[model samples]
Each structure stands twice: as C-alpha cells, then as structure tokens.
Target chain A: MIMGNLGFLLYGNLVLIVILYLYLYKIRKIIGFQLGMNISMLVGGFGAIATGVLLIYQFPLKFVIVTMITAVIGMLIGAIFGALFDYQTLLTGYINGLMMGMMAPMVGAAANNSVLFLLFIEVVFLFSLVLVFLSAKNT
Target chain B: MNISQFLFVLFCLNGVIGLLFYVVMYKKRKLFTDRFGMVMAMVGSGILSFNLAMMLFFMFPFNLGTLAIISTMVGGGIGILYGALTRFQSLLAGFSQGSLGAIMGTMFGAVVENPALCGLPAAYFIDVEQHMMLFSLFGTGLVISTFGLLFYSLRV
Candidate 1:
C-alpha cells in the first residue's frame, strides 16, 4: 500500500515538473537573469529533494545509485533552466543543484518512517511552484 | 601505505592546495569585482568544504556528530577566507554555501561508511572501502580542475 503511494507521488512529481518545464519554456524569453537564477535554483533543488526522497523510500537498498541519479537530475534541471539566461546564472544554478542533490538522499534516509514529513515537503514544493508562477506572471 | 593512511595524505594535500589557491587569489584579489568575488567565494568554499568533509569522514568514521561539527566549522572558515576578498554580502553567501556543503558531505560520508544507517542491508560491506577510495580520488580531481577553472576566469 505504501509502495503504491510512493510510486504515485513520484510519477505525480515528474508530471508536474514536465508541465512546469513547458510553462517555463513558453516564457523563457521574458525571464531576466535574476529571476532566471531563482527559478533554476528553486526547480533544481526541490526537484532533487522530491526525487531523492521518493526514490529512497521506494528502493531503500540502492542508496548509492539513487544518490547519483538524483544529483544528475538536479544538475540537468538547473542547467536547462539557467541556460535561458546568463552564463553566471547557469553556473550558480548548477552548483546549487549539485549541492542540494548531494544532500537530499540523506534527508530522505533520515526521515524514512515519516509519511507526514514527506507530505509536508510536497505541499511546500507545490506552494513554491505556485509562488514562482505568480511571480513570473507579474514580471 | 594503507587505505586510511592514503586518505589522510590526500586530505593533507587537499588542504595545502586549497591554501595555495587562497594565497594566489589573495595576490590577485584586487582584480576581481564584487560579483566575481562572490561567485569565487561561493564556488571555491563550497567545493573545498565538501571535499574536506568527505575525506575527513572517510579517514575517521567514528563519532559522526563530532565529525559533522568539525567539517561544518572548517567549511565556514574556508568560506570566510574566500569571501573576505569581497564585501559583506559575499561573505554571507560564502558562509552559507560552505556550511551547506559541509553538512551534505558529512551526510554522504556517513551513509557511505555504513549503509545500515540508511536502512540499506549490510550486504555491500565489501564495496564500502572501494567506494571511499573512488570518491576521495574523484573529489581530489574535481578540486584541482575547479581551482584551475577559477584561475582561468581571471584571464578572461
């Protein structure tokens, strides 16, 4: 039962990320470097955290592989988002993503038994996404 | 000689290299603007702290709480040193990034040392030592390449 919920959460996150990516792509031209940096960092860090936590929960045995995968995911997301703006933004996003990715799995591991914490994290991520969307729209 | 000894030597080498980079950057600090200095502090401190924490953890796997604290302090120190080249804002950025990196590195080291801590089975015991060696070497290479890139940025 729990495994099923985890899988659902994981897929849901992926879908949300894809949708966000599409939205960002549509407005990529309008984003300034400062906003671009924030967007990249936000997406990269939260995406990595969600991915790491969910994957670790689902597959507790494959710790190392999960860490590597999440780090790569974070790096890619940050780079893609940051690429829309300046090189410095890209560098900032990349480093931030890498650092967050490196940290995420351990957080997941430490909070393994707490479904409530996971839910809270997901809610926070969604709220941030909404905030970003609103901010982007205003700009 | 042994794996632990090798790790210790590598740790010392990394410290020396980090200090040498600091000296070189100090010599040329006046050439950097605020923004560039901020980026330099953030990147340099983050990478150095992460590498240092990971290696230190590998060398001494016992007493994780103490190690984590030590690594974090070391990272903060490095960040302050790097950020001192610039202004207050960069100092703040460097310190935060350094502390974050240190915490992450320490967690990574703890997990690598004992998979069981993360609820992974102990079946991978044989691979733990190998992973440590591989990661430490990779970290060293990363430090060297990153410092080189930072130096090259000055010319451009």
Candidate 2:
C-alpha cells in the first residue's frame, strides 16, 4: 500500500489544518473583519481536516491535494463576503466549499491537461486574492 | 456532460452569483439575511422533492427505489400532519422521527426486494448481481433525502 510521496499525508493532514487556520487568521486580519469571518474560517478549517483524514486513509493523494486547495480558496472567498456582509460568512463559505469541492474535480478532469489544470487553479487563486485585497483596501 | 457534472456546474454558478448579489444588495437593503433560513429551507425542500420524484419514477431497475420513495412520502406526510396539529416542539420531534423512519425503511428495502410487487417493466429489471449495488445507491439517496428534510424542517 506504498503510495509514494503520499506517506507525508498521514500526518501532514494535521499540519495542513494548522497551516490553513493560520492562513484564515491572516486573511481575516487583512480584510479588517471579525465574528462572521472567524466562524467561516473555522468551518472551512474543519472541513479541510475532515477531507484530509478521509483522503489519507481511503482516497488518493491527488484528491487530497485538490480538496484542500479548493476548501482554502472557498474560505478566502467567504472572508470577502464576510467583510461586506456581517453575519452570513459561515454559510457563504459552506456553500462555496460545497460547490467548489463538487465542481473542481470535474473542471480539472474535463480540461484534461495538467498544465491547463494548474493554470485554472492559479487563476482562481489569483482572482480570490485580488478580491480579498480589494475588500481589505476598502475596509 | 453527465447530469451530475451539469448540476455541479449550475450549482457553482449559482453560488458565485448569489454571493455577489448578496454583497451588492446588502449595501442597499439587508432584507435577504432576515429570511436566509427560510430561503435555505425552500431550496433544500425543492432539491429533495426533485430527487425523490426522480428516484421514484426512474429507479425501476430495482425495487429499492420504490420502497425509499414510499418511506419518504409516508414519513413526510405524517410529519406535516403532526406538525400542523401539535406544538412547534412536537412538530420538530415528529419531523425528526419521520426522517429517521425514511432512513430505516430504505435500509430494510435494500435487503429485501419484492420485484413481483414492484411493478417494473421486464426491460428495466436489474440483474440479480447488480441488485445489491443499486440498492446501496438507493439507500444512500434515501439517507441524503432524510437528512435534507431534517435540516429544512429545523430551519422552519
């Protein structure tokens, strides 16, 4: 059952959760937000942890990576909404995570090229980051 | 694209648009958040209704689909009736019980199939070997529908 390079995933998932939480905190501060954003980050963090645990044991490394990335991006988008809307951030993140988790794999598979997939992921990341920065500046 | 992929795409677009709309509208009017729970309930119920209806009519390869639908309908009807007659707490309790019943009934259905009584066309009948697999899928749908109802009811 040696699935090369995935060996780190067994324990790396725990570390990943910690890193994700820190990132959430940093992004929340940058956006000058509180309460709702915190809750959203917590939800997203827990979701990533759950996915990580499941992937480590039952699924492939690729799924683990994709899900973790998608969940983090979802939280960032949620934070942007949290800045604009005071109380709906947690629910927003949940919805985003649900949609992203379900759709990202399909988009990746449909594109059918590693380069294209990476390009798409990077673009989404950049877009979310830009939104976050704009919201932060407005605040 | 497959139905699921199509649905996922639609869901993603909805999420993005909904988020943007909420942000834009919040500046002008905060009405949306006030009814968020109800809105979520409506969406959840609508999706469950569609899924349950689909399962009932299309899942003719095995008898489990019919059983799941029956269980869900019976449970939901009893829940709504009890809710209408009793206190809110009683309504909630009854709804939860009904959802649980739907799940338990679906499990039972998966294990036992009365194909003779199922009334499916011969062409749609599942092979003996695939029965268990399809039953599991039907059972999963039942579980999702049950939880979804429970969530929607609680929101109400």
| Top candidate when judged by TM-score against the true structure | 1
- The C-alpha lDDT values of all candidates are 0.83, 0.41
lDDT of 1 by residue, B93-138 (tens): 9999899889888988887888777766677687998878877886
Clashing pairs in 2: none
Candidate 2 structure quality by residue, lDDT tens digits, A1-139: 2334334543544454345445545655545335445445444433433333334233322432444355455445444444343434544444334334423433343333334444344444445444544454456
Task: Give candidate 1's error at residue A98 in angstroms.
Answer: 1.5
TM-score of each: 0.84, 0.36
Candidate 1 local lDDT, A64-98, one digit each (tens): 77877887788787777777776666667767777
Question: What stretches of model 2 exceed 4 Å from their correct place?
Answer: A1-88, B1-33, B42-156
Report the lDDT of model 2 for residue B99.
55
For B23-118, candidate 2 gives per-residue lDDT tens digits of 443343332333343223222322233233233333345465566667577556545443333245434544654455455445433322433332
Error of 2 at B156 (Å): 13
TM-scores of chain A across the candidates, in order, are: 0.93, 0.43
Model 1 segments more than 4 A misplaced: A5-12, A113-115, B20-24, B124-126, B141-156
Q: Each candidate's chain B TM-score?
A: 0.95, 0.31
DockQ of each: 0.38, 0.01
